[model samples]
Target: MDVVIAPDEQIGEIVADDIAALIAARPDAVLGLATGSSPLRIYDAVAERVARKQLSLARARGFMLDEYVGLPPGHPCRYSTVIDEDFVSRVDFAPGAVRGPDGDAADLTAACTDYEESIGEAGGVDLQILGIGTDGHIAFNEPGSSLASRTRVKTLTAQTRADNARFFGGDIDAVPRHCVTQGLGTIMDARRIVLVATGDAKAEAIAHLVEGPVSARWPATVLQHHRRVTVLVDDAAASRLELADYYRHAHAHRHLVS
Candidate 1:
């Protein structure tokens, strides 16, 4: 695990820098996209780079991390539409280059199987962007989720619904109770992973994710087994990390890393 503590405003740029470099080296690099407020800045940075001709995603393909089940097509909150508005609309990705699980599928099990197969056929994700929940979940894989699970439908925990209520006009009741998400085992398949987090609400989760033991209780902890994972967090989020000082020192001396 490589933890890099940066200012709240800069974390996105740092992640974006790595992404831009990847696209420059491999224009068609597959990206695993995450939703929610945590990744907005990164999207902005990538879009700006495209606007400035410093970067282009015309050939890149993206796969979203999760989607809310039963949301009507064109629903603003749907992950597919959200990804379109949040990132795809601002860049030059080819039409139909991005995909998300079919949250409205009549046969959700088949949908999950096809989604997984699609990812494998794309040669798997080159780099995955992720966000940690206040409760330490990643991609809606709530506490107690199987460590070896794959893409599938999951019941949203009450905590997750409440946390996401803001997106549904602050009405927790309006938040969907079910979602389809990539499992921890599936996320671990990515060649590289970049997780972003911020704010005091995420402090404890960030701490556990970076320094705690790997366990199903904290789904994001599963990433500890991934070979290449970079965790980018702001000061507030890193406040509870026991080795914050060491992480900062290592980041400062990152040039020494081969």
Candidate 2:
């Protein structure tokens, strides 16, 4: 796995732009996109590139990491609606190129199965973007989750609900307790994964992911077992690491050599 510590959001945008260019070059790019503040800058940069005709989302397929299970399809908190507002609608991707959990699916299990099948039919994800929860969860795969889990429903922990309540107008009661997420097995199937993290709140999780032993309790730490994984962070997010400078310098030297 590779670690990159950018000076600020601009450098983060640059990193995302490079990924956009990579996807553009390979028309069949299938991206696993994440929803949250961490990836907003990256999405903005990619959207601008698409608007300027520098990148094309045509022939590319998009997948979202998770969605609120009980929310209506058009609900503001639904992952589909959020992805549309934040990234998909702003870019030039084909009208139906994006796929996310169906919040309104009558048979939620079948919906998850179909989603997983669709991903498999498309030859799996080329790049999976991720955001780390303050509690070290990734895509709702909370602490103690099975490493081999498949697409399924999950109950939100109190911490997670609290963290997301701000989006629901600070009404924790309005936050949905359940969500549909791709399994750890499904996420690991991706050929490449890029996990983005920011803020001091994420420092402990970031440190554990980078230097701790492999464990399901901290799902993102499983990236250590992947052949192609990149962990990108801003200075604040790398605060808890003892070798933060080493990580920063290594990426710098590697980029220079390349």
Candidate 3:
């Protein structure tokens, strides 16, 4: 994993630079999109690039990380809707180019299977954007999720519901109790992964994800096993990392070696 400690305002540009480069090389690159506060800046940066005519997502495709189960059609909180409001609508992605697992399908198992097949048929994701939960969960794959799991429905942990309550007007009861999410195994197949975190609230999770031993209890730690992963964090989020100085030194010298 390549750890990048950048200022909160600048991390988005750093990640966007990489994505822009990828899109330049592969105009039809498939992207794994994550919703929530962590990736808003990335989307904003990408949108800015499109406005400047420096980038275009006209032929790109996207797969969302997860979708809340039982949300009514057109519900603002639905992951699909959220993705559209947050990122897709602001860019140039072709119509119907983004897809997510069906959270309200009559046969959820079949939906999960189909979603995984769709990703495989698209030649897999070129890059996946990720955000870690305060409890270390990734894409609703809470603690104890199978390390090699695939796309599937998962019960939302109480803490997860509570954390997401803010999006539902601070009412925990309003949040969905289940979701369909891409599994760790599915995320691992992406050619590259970019995980972002910020603020003091994420410090502990960042510490475990970067320095702690790989364990199911902290699902983000699984990134340690991926062949290509980039972790971007602000100073506040990197507070708990014990090897902070070393990470800084390594990042500073990486350009020299390359």
lDDT tens digits by residue: candidate 3, 1-258? 999999999999999999999999999999999999999999999999999999999999999999999886689999999999999999999999999889989999999999999999999999999999999999989999998999999999999999999999999999998999999999999999999999999999999999999999999999999999999999999999999999999998896534
lDDT of each: 0.93, 0.86, 0.95
Q: How would you encode candidate 2's per-residue C-alpha lDDT over 138-178 as one tens digit per residue?
A: 89888877888888888989999999999999999999999
Q: What TM-score does candidate 2 reach?
A: 0.96
In model 2, the worst 10-residue window by lDDT is 7-16
What's model 3's overall lDDT? 0.95
Q: How would you order the candidates by TM-score, starting with the best? A: 3, 1, 2
Q: In model 1, where is the ten-residue run with the lowest total lDDT?
A: 249-258
Q: In model 1, state the lDDT of residue 163.
A: 90
Worst lDDT run of 10 residues, candidate 3, spans 249-258
Q: Give per-residue lDDT, candidate 3, residue 59.
A: 96
Q: Flag regions of model 2 displaced more than 4 Å.
A: 255-258
Candidate 2 structure lDDT: 0.86
Tens-place lDDT per residue, model 1, 1-258, is 999999988988998999998998999999999999999999999999999999989999999999999998899899899999999999999999999999999999999999999999999999999999988999989999999999999999999999999889999998999999998889999999999999999999988898899988888998888999999998999999999999999989877646
Better of 2 and 3 by TM-score: 3
- The best-first sequence of candidates by lDDT reads 3, 1, 2
Candidate 3 residue spans exceeding 4 A from truth: 256-258
